[model samples]
Target: MRVDSRTLPLVPLLLGPVGALQLPLLGGSSSASQAPIAADKPLISSPLLQEQVKAENLMQRARQLYKIAELGEGEYNHPTRVIGSKGHLGTLDYIYSTLTNLGDYYTVSNQSFPAVTGNVFESRLVLGHTVPESATAMSLTPPTKHKEPVYGQLVAVANLGCDASDYPSDLDGAIAFISRGQCPFGTKSELAGKAGAVAAVIYNNEKGDMSGTLGTPSPDHVATFGLSDTDAAPFLEQLHKGEKVDGIAYVDAIVESISTTNIIAQTTGGDPDNCVMLGGHSDSVGEGPGINDDGSGSLTLLELATLLTEFRVNNCVRFAWWAAEEEGLLGSDYYVSVLTAAENKKIRLFMDYDMLASPNFAYQVYNATNALNPVGSEELRDLYVEFYEAHDLNYTFIPFDGRSDYDAFIRNGIPGGGIATGAEGVKTVTEQGMFGGVAGEWYDPCYHQLCDTVANLNLTAWEWNTKLVAHSIATYAKSFDGFPKRVEETSISSFAEEPKYHGPFLRQ
Candidate 1:
């Protein structure tokens, strides 16, 4: 998911909101009506499990879901399945219908919540004599456009405008020429505004045009625009040669509070007090259909839920399809916030799956053992490592920085771990040697863009990761012998704050 920290008033739960009242409620009723299992039958038989959950079977089901998502885009004008849109709603319905048809094996319900949505209507940056070269506005930037093309003399700031002293004394009436590096776009723009500049233009230090967040809003912020190196080179050269350069930057946008829903399903069989929860975000960014970003993960869970009904689980398994995760983990946070102390204790461990298939892929496990070692997190991490080693496949570790939907669970003192292929971050030489993909290219070249369609998926990564997800469900759902037991006094304050704004280009 991308970093967008614009905080608006959260609308109440689905019970309080009328917009969510329109969505179809799928799945069986609560577990109170579930029939008791006979004690004579085995909780789960190993021989019966092998017959189901084959990789081929799972992959075929996943591909079918992908086709459903592809068809969802046909009903919408834009090529996206973003939350609160018709395309996303269609995807949600597909999940609900597929599970509800499984005859009484699972109990499902929809948990709705409110979110604030933002979209850019118009954004442009005219740098030189001609109309502005191609540019895009940063996410969550305030909508401000000059009615009369307000002009300012361009003045380059020192040190990429990361520090307060980088702003020049003469930048009062001019546009601050800040390069994107060392800090977030919000910080640079805020500092420029504090220095009395009318606006700020940040050019990328890398190859592409800048497209990122200012993290969150601040009072000391001006209208900010991002430009690529190719677009800003000539202007920088002219300014260095002591020639005056003037330009106009304009932005128009809309931010509003909206309502969305999260779908939660649980098994009717198994011990409810010792539940194993697994999940992924159901919503996508506004840019594309997000088939690979999380469609891969969400569908994997759906396929597993459908197939798991063929056998019985010893422990309860809950599947959650979170909403508005790209909007700063809102859906999951609300879900956790409302949990009673007993409900929180019932969850044994939570595993999250996101972006399981990137075109240029590396098998990545959440680094719970080494980096962010929560209580039972290490045992969860070792499960993936053991799975990869036993299969003779290569895998690496990614920091547990709380960048995905898992953030809410870990922050609430719930032990969590999961798998991810990769996102906008580039692959290293070592990762290339292990995974056989381009070293410097992004794992998903189409991440968070309009190009992240069905064609951009890596089927090999998708298949393998889906198999691992199945293995996790089957293994833990059957027993929790070696896993750590939940402690009553686990403090929520023990975990540190979720890591801040580590985007693709800003990885340290």
Candidate 2:
């Protein structure tokens, strides 16, 4: 669920109110429980369909997992369920343990993969007579420490610092003030460093304070910090008036590679040759516990899996809890890349669940049929529409642009579709009329921030969406009569390669 740059305000507010944050402890009993089926017993005769999908059950399960994510904090001096952390590993352990306890109903495996994780130990910026400004360190910025304040004459660069020519010749001992736009932040920082700038300060082109990665570290780059336009305006105005402005910028961080696991579970009793796959990222962003952003999606699948054990299926249903989705679609991409051509063809369709419980929610389905019409994508979209219409709910279509875990599957020509409430994107007047939320506010005000805890979720939206997940799973797991046939000879090389799309939102 990438944030669109076009939807962002010029002056974005601070990430969230600052205060002491606490991570939740993991030990607790789930709200919903089912006795495990004995390994020697015959399977149940009836399929527990949509009627059995309870909102209370979903909410309870979601609360249990949110508690696990809270346990991911303390270690990093911040509350985050980011991948490769204790919190996220606890999440994985809980999922694995739950499925394992279900006995012979399912076979679960953990697929290990390496991912680069970053942690910011310290980030600070002091400007204009030692006034400390709020700031965040960009991911992938090399560790940098200024033991003492290093004062430098501020030099304003012409245009956004996308090119070397934008840098002034006298930047050797000055701090370069660059505008954000037209290129990667790393590119701008590299150019500034090459021109001999001691450090680089990038102010947002829009209204808010800016925080972004320099992409990756470079030998030619120097220390860099992001500033909102409001914070930088006075300095820029003074510099333009031929007045010298001196400032101190400091940052220290550690970026390193770590191993993480993606949990894959499948029904032990369905057709292995043609499988229905559904997934949600198991990891969260560094800002906070991503209970709604993805914990809703992941736990939805987990709860569905638990309940689905009461029924049998004709087609195999596989669920994946992806890792490192926050750092890009690393887990899913790696999983897809390692699949044998035969393995790729065994998948009938892929459904993604990224953010399902936005506070000011809208029922947005992937517009696969009318827009990006990838193979059997239309059928998946239609299924969601039919489900909503039958329940007397209004629904809208979001573009089937590859922005979530579905991207890797669609890129390989496997038909895919999914649902999202909304994230960062503001609700429209028309949407308010249909879904009844504030028209101008974000669907999830706490998106990717410290506030995105269990309280951040809309239980109504989460409940309804979880039921929909069950409906979709039940519908497809029973049979793929209207869906496309598996392409036995499909080749990854034969498919048209689509560029990976990373939106400004969160993960893409």
Candidate 3:
């Protein structure tokens, strides 16, 4: 996630006025004593092309979109390339091109936001409990200019690693040495500020490199240098022995304002009174072309949009291509915040497609019961089960961890669900055994790395998953009123409920 907790506002309501409708009952003649046979409608065995003129047209357009996206496979992070403008400008261009090409298909709206880029690093501490070599800052750490070493007394406090309450008010002039146990680095910094600490030193509770951001600065204070536990243990021990500890946390302030876009397109001739939104981030990470990371989801929706454009949808369908997903779901979050209460009421669902195609990977569904996290939605669970059975596809369900765009939509009470192909570093044993791929491998070897290129893409995997997304999207778009049937909501307690173990997803 790029930006922490920041979000763009939603576009104003631009949908046209709804017209009135009327339904009438025709008179029937009295029947004789003879029994009558009823007409058996043909099964909807295949995609109905004639009835789905729009779907066919969309598919035709999708074929073109897919080709264009293929050309952009390794270009996800190129500023001059198709995916470079991950923040806003690029999203606007894509949306503009589609809207302009579609002309009267639907109204187009643009929402603007500020882009902030900061130093992001992963600090690593050596295996030893007291080795300096074990501790290193993330590569993206900002250059600390030649400034005086800011020092203070080191204070070790539990639960203060990332929340605002972790820091003590009396430690205003002291250095706070905290433990990295739960939450994110950004969160730890937020807590440090509340504790009145001048600088924060976070040590690892467990052995491993710590990757994430040291929270962004508030208007009141600046946070810098989230240290590894191994590196800070010596000083922290001294503090524990009533000895004062001091160190520097220098930060070269880098802040900039930039623009990004949200590409939105809608279908015509549907129940304009209600609408459903399907979307994914169009931007990739700063490193590689996000061909698999998100280009899969973005392209899948693009293709789905192409199909929906020509089909006569029963409900209004809005296709959104968001920017800055790598930045903490900013684009989609912004879109959600800006919707009026009335606008929100009209939304039927929000289905997000993110990283839908991994070369050869498990098909995982989000929204399931877990012994750890209790975020499973029964309505969504059944819908996925039904879809899989209807399509004769195999899938596995995992607990939702609020990691994707669906979080924002669900926050507003909109039912949401989608698919994932896979990614590096999280593959299942079954996937390797069946697909002849690496077992115990990352779902994607190139995730967030420089190697996430077109060559790394698995075309077969992409095609199969793309079809799955298209089918689900089309199914939901056509039958919004009948899907995501309501399910029981459960409360979240401690983390014990979340499943710590991993299993095969999308395996037969």
Q: What is the TM-score of each candidate against the true structure?
A: 0.78, 0.78, 0.69
Evaluated at residue 476, the lDDT of candidate 1 is 80
Q: Give the TM-score of candidate 1.
A: 0.78
Cα distance off (Å), candidate 2, residue 247: 4.8
Task: Please write out the lDDT profile of model 2 over residues 1-508, one tens digit for every residue.
Answer: 1111222111111111122233322133422233443455433222345557677777777777666666666775666788766667767767766775675567666677777776666766666685536355566655543433456788999998877888989898778898877777778878988998877888877876566665445777777777778878888889989998887766676677777878788887678988999999988887788889798899889988888887777778999999888776778988998888888988988999989999999999988772454578888999999989988999999976656888788777688899999988889999999999899999999988888887888888887888888888877777889777755445444344443233222110
lDDT, candidate 3, at 168: 64
Q: Tell me model 1's lDDT, rounded to 2 decimals.
A: 0.74
1-508 per-residue lDDT for model 1 (tens digits): 1101222233212211212323332222421323343445555643355445455555565555454445445445456666766556766766765666665677766676776556666776777685656567766566663423346888899987989899999898778999887677888988998998877888888897566665446767777777788888988899899998887767776556778877778887888999999998877777777878788888888877877776778899999998877766777888888888888988888999999889899999999862455578889999999988988999999988867877777777788999999998899999999999899999999998877777777888887787788888878889999888887743466674535543222211
- Candidate 1: minimum summed lDDT over ten consecutive residues — where? 1-10
Clashes of each: 1, 10, 43
Better of 2 and 3 by lDDT: 2
Off by over 4 Å in 3: 1-88, 119-155, 158-175, 181-184, 191-199, 203-209, 214-216, 220-253, 368-377, 387-393, 434-436, 484-508
lDDT, candidate 2, equals: 0.74
Error of 1 at 212 (Å): 2.6
Tell me how far the alpha carbon of residue 168 in candidate 1 is from the true structure, in angstroms, after superposition: 9.1
Weakest lDDT window of 10 consecutive positions for candidate 2: 8-17
Tens-place lDDT per residue, model 3, 260-349, is 656666655456556767887766666555666676677667655644445555667777877656655667877878877666656666
